[model samples]
Target: MPQYSIKDHLYESQLFINRSIAAAIIVTLMLLLLGVRMVYLQVVSHEHYTTLSKDNRVKLQPLPPTRGLIYDRNGVILAQNLPAYSLEITPEKVESLEQTIEQLALILPISEEDRRRFKKLRRQRRPLRQYPDPSTPER
Candidate 1:
């Protein structure tokens, strides 16, 4: 059986000081590592990240070709292109999409349902779509 003194204040303070010095060293190392990483990212890797951000800011999407009616030798349409009126607005071109929609509502007699559908479809950004037959004349 080993017995230790309860009144060892100097030993306790020495242990505390040792632990404190170790903790300080660890914290200082972590801070130095963090600072080095920050410097690398901000200085060395700055241009690479800047170009990536710029590329992301401006995206190029090709417009799909309009499907024209394909005819056979015997005056029969092998394939027919559906009639549709597509309106495309680049988000970057428009300052305010909501305001543009409001302006369009005045001209196009658009309702809340139409506005809601437009908003929903705008997120999709489908360039072209086929519309159902509504007394469409054959071309």
Candidate 2:
């Protein structure tokens, strides 16, 4: 004859319920910790991060210092900076070089010497290049 055994249903149900409660508690605690850390970063340290972001966005460029005048031992000015204006024309931009020069002459005091110099420079310069006219009147 074989021996018979009975299952304890009540004890098994209690054990399963205990394990489920422990797992739920652990998950809830982890979620709470994550929420607290997010709040600290978003509210507490907001200004510090905001300032860093603003500084990164805005750039600072240093301006070049003005050049000083040089003098000789006898107090005579050896070298000094003077402002001068000149017109530059790009060969590619103008449709008719002769017509454009004529029109510019009417508006500005473009003398015969200026015209001749401009023509010479234009011929010597590589195509689509701009050369400063040497005949520009000193201001």
Candidate 3:
């Protein structure tokens, strides 16, 4: 036969109740802190966040920077953008660029080498794509 002392103790109920109260108090404190932080963001730090949000939404540009004159020790212009004329004609503006090139050849001494170089530069500036004119039949 096994003998039992059977001392369950009366403090077990009090210990469980104390632990439950502590847990509830900790949870309530965490929720209180969260609520306080939310209120602080909405009311106290409102303008700061509003300015940042506005800065993202609005695009504010600065004035164009001025180009200054640069000179060397020997009074020579190191760099400058002086008034210069260039024969710039849009490729799309010209109906037949071959005829245009022939006309320009009459005025300027543009060699076959120069025409090849110009075509190379044009290819770099604009992508090569065949645009078939509906008015003229494709050759």
- What's each prediction's TM-score? 0.48, 0.42, 0.40
Sorted by TM-score, highest first, which candidate order results?
A: 1, 2, 3
Better of 2 and 3 by TM-score: 2
Q: lDDT (CA) for every model shown?
A: 0.68, 0.79, 0.69
lDDT, model 1, position 128? 45
User: Quick one: RMSD of model 1?
Assistant: 10.4
- Give the per-residue lDDT of model 2 (tens digit) for 3-108: 9989899999999999999999999999999999999999999999999999996666655436868999999998887764566778787798778777777778
Q: Write the per-residue lDDT of candidate 1 for residues 60-128, one digit (tens) a residue.
A: 666665777899999999988554543445655668867876776666666666656655655665434
Q: Which ten residues in a row have the lowest lDDT in candidate 1?
A: 130-139
TM-score of 3: 0.40
Error of 2 at 15 (Å): 51
Clashing residue pairs in all predictions, respectively, total: 0, 0, 0
Candidate 1's TM-score = 0.48
Index of the highest-lDDT prediction: 2
How many clashing pairs does model 1 include?
Answer: 0
Candidate 2, position 66, lDDT: 68
